[model samples]
Target chain A: MWQEPRYQKETVRENPVEEVKKITFRPATDIYEMPDGFKLLLEMPSVDRETLKVYIKDNQLHIEGEKKKDVSDGKFLLQEIRDVAYERVFELGDDIDADSISARYEQGILEITLKKKEKEPVKEIKIQ
Target chain B: MYRPFPPFGSEFMKEFQQFREQLNELLKNVASGDVHLASDVMYPAVDVIEQDQQYVYVVELPGVKKEDVKLMVKDNSLVLEGERKEPEMGQDVQKIRGEIAYGKFQRTLPLPENADLDKIRAEYKNGVLLVHIDKKEETKPRLIDVQVQ
Candidate 1:
């Protein structure tokens, strides 16, 4: 006897909990290829150094940052800038060495460098 | 191979859709802005506020150096000039996507009579510039005393 599923055999259930994000924005980025490997530049204004994070996992690079709005109480005669979060990710290939990656954030621009691995020796073939 | 980064996750895609809607709103309000069709996205997004004692200006200039920015008052107007130099991209480098605006730009805004341009002060931090200007006492709206002769 099949227990507990005779009438609900094809029923599908989705996760009941999902957190709604308050605000979200995508930061602009520029990718460049260097002699050694690659360079990436991202613009994320007002994000604190401590709030920024960059890490690689499963050969994918992820960059995330958050900017908190000022809590000062004042009448906003003109409102334009607002606090928001930024996220960007990229896939890495084996040609680049992930262990040698380095990054720096300054003036709201994050720069990341990924060094490439040494090329393997080539074997010559002679045609008869 | 160089390629524009795709939406890495569903969260990114959802955010991108919302951002696109907001951009469309901006596009619809073309009359309020000097938006050039050729160059829609520009640098140094600014906000101006008028307070009782002063006027405030906030500008966003990411990746720009302080020395590169120039602020001045000319003909009773506030003038801002700056240049964002492009990072050297070698021949082997291929462009994936470019959204940030670069190169020199100039913006001039007319000031009100109450603005004391000479008393302006500016501070730059976290790639944002905040400018404060004291209000001119003479131009402040006030009631004059009247006496009977």
Candidate 2:
């Protein structure tokens, strides 16, 4: 004998909500390969240290921040700069040591350094 | 066909009008040419905002030092000049990629009629320069009460 479990098939509905879309721009970057590591420089104007975020996830480097407008209430005589967030990402090579990465932010420029991992030496096997 | 030229409508007047139009076209081309030349150098982004008491000018100059920038007010125009030097790296370092613009930049913005040039103040922070110019006292809006008869 087989018994069927009683259950109610209720449809789940999601409420519609309005969302604000934010504009994002990619900051200009310069990459250099140093003797022992790699250095990356990003130019992100008006982005302060407190708002900037730099991290590595899944072997990819991510940098993002928002440029806040200090004066919000004003009539624009000439508007050229836009209120937007800056984001950029780069893929990391396997030779890079993720644990030894370091960064510094100054003068609206972010500098990140990624060190290379130590290579394993080759073992010479003697004739048996 | 040649007839006696009327004093009011003559060929000289038509020639003058044509000359004026040509002069206007030439001036427009020259103005646009100047903008094209300016673009050859670095043109930093700028924003001018007007407030009740003052006008603010914001200029973005990243990777530039404060000492390298110069601001001056001359002939009812604000002149901004700066240079962005490339960072020095080690001799063994190799460039993988470069996208940043580095060079001398000059930008001039005309001041508004109501701006008080003498009261201009500037500040620089985080590679952004802010210039505040107070508005003329008499030019500001004022509320006047009308006397009832």
Best by DockQ: 2
Tell me the tens digit of each residue's lDDT in model 2 across B4-119: 76676677799889999987866654432211122225678899999999999999887899999999998999999989988999699998777677889999999999999899
* DockQ-based CAPRI category assigned to the predicted complex of candidate 2: acceptable
TM-score of each: 0.66, 0.74
Question: Which sections of candidate 2 miss by over 4 Å?
Answer: A1-20, A124-128, B1-40, B139-149
lDDT of 2 by residue, A1-128 (tens): 01112212221222122133445556777789987889989878888567699998888788887786756678998988866666666778888899998998778788999899888898989999
For model 1 chain B, give the 10-residue run with minimal summed lDDT.
B29-38
Model 1: per-residue Cα lDDT over A1-128, one tens digit each: 00111122122223123233434445667677667788888878778677689988777788877764422343555566754566656677778787988998888788898888988889788998
In candidate 1, how many Å is residue B44 off? 2.1
CAPRI classification of candidate 1: acceptable
